[model samples]
Target chain A: MRIFEYMGKELFSRFGLRVPKGRVVTTAYEAAWVATEIGSVAIKAQVLSGKRGKGGGIKFADTSAEAKKAARELLGMKIEGHTVEKLLIEEKLHIDREFYLSVTIDGGAKKPVIIASSQGGMDIEEVPENKIVKVHLDVELGIHPFIARNIVRRLGLDVGSRQGKELLNIILAAYKIFQEKDAILVEINPLVFCGEKIIAADAKVIIDSEALFRQKDIPYIEEQTEAEKLAQDLGISYVELEGDIAVMANGAGITMSTLDIIQRYGGAPADFMDVGGGTDMEATAKALEILLAKDPKVIFINIFGGITRCDDVAGAFAKVKKEHGIPVPVVIRLVGTNQEEGRRILREQGIEAYTNMDEAAAKAVELAALVPAGSL
Target chain B: MAIIVDQNTRVMVQGITGKQGSFHTRQMLAYGTKVVAGVAPGKGGSKFEDIPVYDTVRAVLQEHQVDASVIFIPAAFAKDAVLEALEAGIGTVVVITEHIPVQDEMEFIAYAQRKKAVLIGPNTFGIVSSGKCKIGIPPNQFFMPGPVGMVSRSGTLTYEIAGNLIAAGFGQSTAVGMGGDRIVGLTFIDVLKLFEADPETKAVVLIGEIGGNAEEEASVYIKEMTKPVVAYIAGKSAPPEKRMGHAGAIIRRGKGTYEGKVKALAEAGALVAEMPSEVPEMIRKLLA
Candidate 1:
């Protein structure tokens, strides 16, 4: 769950991190009012995607009129599939320098790591390795002040100076937020050095979805795509892809392997849909209906039945085919746990169920080739 | 030569009074696993399937000299259940519960490391030493005692590959589901080293997905390994940043990618199969 920038800043401020006074506005008029209230405002588009500055989604306005114009222009603009419905208007500052800092779970290390860089306000990838500092925090030891001081020193800031002391406080406070919030990532891009104080100019926070039960009162903004919403409604796992063929499986690993085989056989998967274990007829029909709604040229269903009976999947595919009077080609590979009975049911419905995954994937890809790519 | 459990290994089923716990406990018993004891907090002084039940792992340890523990507890109480097993000096703990929070996982992992215990998973199908002892919910008929040691991240994928391996005349010595969650207990490296040491295992089949650098890290270990390894990396066609049902199956920052994992395994001299069906043939050729 990603908290919006304004909410991130609000959470950061609550944790003792210094942030510029900001207000979230949904309209250009509201943005203008906030800009007038706080002179020299920065109108930052409220979108989840990064690189907002490079995308021209963020703009600086010296006057209220200019803020309103910038808001109007960015309000309806699209950045990485997210429409800018809101803007975060904040008091702009005269920054002496900018530094990037973040606390995120280093997947490789399986631990929380603090990433600090002297070069900030841009992509961390662009920064050289020598300038960036990474410190992996141990579960037993945690983030010590000395660790923060070392990172501060590596950032070329004097540990004895006032600005350095303030930066250390910010890093410690940010680490506190990372621990308290059960956050997957908490990043403050451009922790600006303005005169005597340090301010967080932009903030990003992603809370762990599994930790939501413990993290009460967090304003979690779940931005699900339409397909994702429908999949969630049906209690199925679905992820949309950029292709012309829909793929369905009983398990995540099998689904992925199905996608691999389809692509290997010169086909592209339109979406990934896993019906999960022991899915009955109604749920299977719903899953197929959801995939059909995407209007793919081909639908491939792969089920290595195991404890989940193949007859259950077969009956569901038949029921779905009959109910929708399916137009697109449906290829199913059902094996193990009553596979013969499953194939018999599919045959009764005038549908063929292959026993081998390779044969079924090949057939699906061959059928998919009959239609032009992306024609769906 | 099974790595984790065998006929001599005495096992205890934690949370054996619950629905999933009781069901899989029965399955494990039927599979000839020596399930000596059961731990259900409120269901003490009771017998589940004629096996003794205790309120806690410590009490269960008093009656039976259990060597390994299989946990079927809910995700909320899994941390305590695992710790209880470790506290009772149980060296091998297999957590079959899914959806354990990452923080709890970190704590338990650290605790397990301190105790010098082998923790399998908080979300796994559990380990099965083929035709000898089985734990957790994998369908047992798909397996047979053979020379190929299998390790995988996903449950159903393990079943599929194991079944295919059986059909292709290459039964497994032991199949370990390392769990699909982001923070699993026994990683690929841990199990790969076990397979390398087990004398009965002639070769190994590693099943991986687009997840944390476990596979990439395993590839580095595999480079140093002498035994032949065959790998099948899933999500080859999966889109970047899309969570493919598994909590750990997303690619971020050019890491944990299907292509990167496959390339790394290939570079390490492991045959990377395109699909699960192709795994058995590759493993057979390696052993041949």
Candidate 2:
């Protein structure tokens, strides 16, 4: 998960990388107080999305009153759809030179890659490819001392020089943090050399969500839409999207295929929900309830039942209709293990489940088109 | 012969006494797979479903000379279980446990490489060679031995496409789930290479989604292969940077997009199907 800059910097400090002293404040008054103590601070809005500087979510404050004004402008403002709920006030740095360094998994290579460049401040993509030196770390042996020195030397810094030593330390620390935190990425956009020292001007750390179970100390921030949160509470995977048709399936592959088929037939899917394998009747009912909250014009349920029982899905459909009453048109396609029993259950409930996926997808799209836009 | 396994392949089940282990073990046995033995750390000297249970993989290896091992241990102890199987000289290890720590996977994958062993997955559904043998949890009815070679990242999606192929009068030579994780051991290229060399396999079906460079990398290799290939990529409508059920399914930094994968595969001469149901028709046309 992507963390706030303050959290990333906090992690950097713990890993022995130098970061400018920073304080997190929630209100404009507190931002002013922290800025006064820091003396010429950078006021950064603590939102998850990047490009905050270009989006005007970041500001420079020379004095306490200026900091207050900047904070006021940043607070309660939405930058890239995320509101600035908190501000990170950090001591401004005087840099002799700026460089970039990051350690991230190269998905194609299936190895950890270190990307270092002499250019900084601008987007890494904007930097010319020739100026950047990329190195892939061995997954088994990890980062050798020579590999670290190679990156720093290529950046044109002397190994014995203060900035060079500091750069090496920062690179090592970043790799350590990336490894220890089970992080997918750990990046310092501008590792600035200030006279005799180097400090991380900006930091970004993204922890692997699947590895969160082992890293118990790191706090997980649940950033989700209201509909997403509702699905989470029901123990189902849900992703909110634009459009009027609600899409539900028993597996991730079928769910995505269902989504694709709907769009192929000129229908827009409002959400993506997967009930997962071996789901029972109650869980299916809960999944239905969560999707119902999205209030789509059509609800399309597709189950390619393997270990997942179709009878359970049919039972849930019957239960949900008998209790909550579905307001929209429901289209379902059930196949595979226990499919006959599932179809029988749905048929008894006066709801027909299609055996062909193509037929079901077309029908759902046709029904969705029949409803006027914004009618739901 | 199939790429990974056939009727003659000897198999062993690790964590055989556990709930999922016993359940899928029975399923595998019922499908005519040569499940010779089982291994549960403390369940040695016991028998599960008429199969001898050993405490360690070494002991199981002593009696059966197993060709592959399908692991069904809990996520917490999966790394050690796989390591044990690798250490016991099992050339092929299929890890069926999901949610294994990435660190653990990294270590085990490196170790497996050192031992010259093939690690299928840390979160896979294993491999099935149609009517010959089945080593995974895919429903038996969805498969029938024939000429199509299939490789997929997701388990259910593989089954979905396989069922569609069967309904359309096509059958699979070998279907492999390469695991739906970021750091899977067996990749699309790895399985594709095997399928390319297998005589029974006539064409290839690559099942991928909107994450990782597996599909992109596979396209590079497919550009040279002579066998016809058809692909179905999921998550075409998925949002960027959101985990869509599968942990590996995400679009980050403008990479791993559905359109990009489809374009690459199409450029490599592989027919790209818009939906799972469409894959069979594409394969039929390619062979025709």
Q: Give the Cα error of residue A203 in candidate 1, in Å.
A: 1.2
lDDT of 1 by residue, B1-288 (tens): 799888788999999989889888888888999999999988899999999999988788677798999999887788899999998899899998877777777778778888999999877888999888998788768889999999998888888888888889988899999988887778999899999999989999999999788998998999999999999888888777678888888886567887788889999989988778888878877877
For residues A8-45, what per-residue lDDT tens digits would candidate 2 score against the true structure? Answer: 99899898998988899999999899988989999999
Question: Between which residue pairs do clashes occur in model 1?
Answer: A245-A270
Could you give candidate 2's per-residue lDDT for residues B17-108 as a string of tens digits?
A: 89888989988988999999999987899999899999998888677889999999988889899999998889899999987877678778
TM values, all candidates: 0.96, 0.97
CA deviation > 4 Å runs, candidate 2: A226-230, A233-235
lDDT by residue (tens digit), candidate 1, A280-375:
777888888888888899888899887678898888888877777888888988888888999999899888788788999999989988987556
Those runs of model 1 whose alpha carbons end farther than 4 Å from true positions after fitting are A322-324, A371-376
lDDT of 1 at B49: 91
- Give the lowest summed-lDDT range of ten residues in model 1 chain A: A104-113
In terms of TM-score, which candidate is strongest?
2
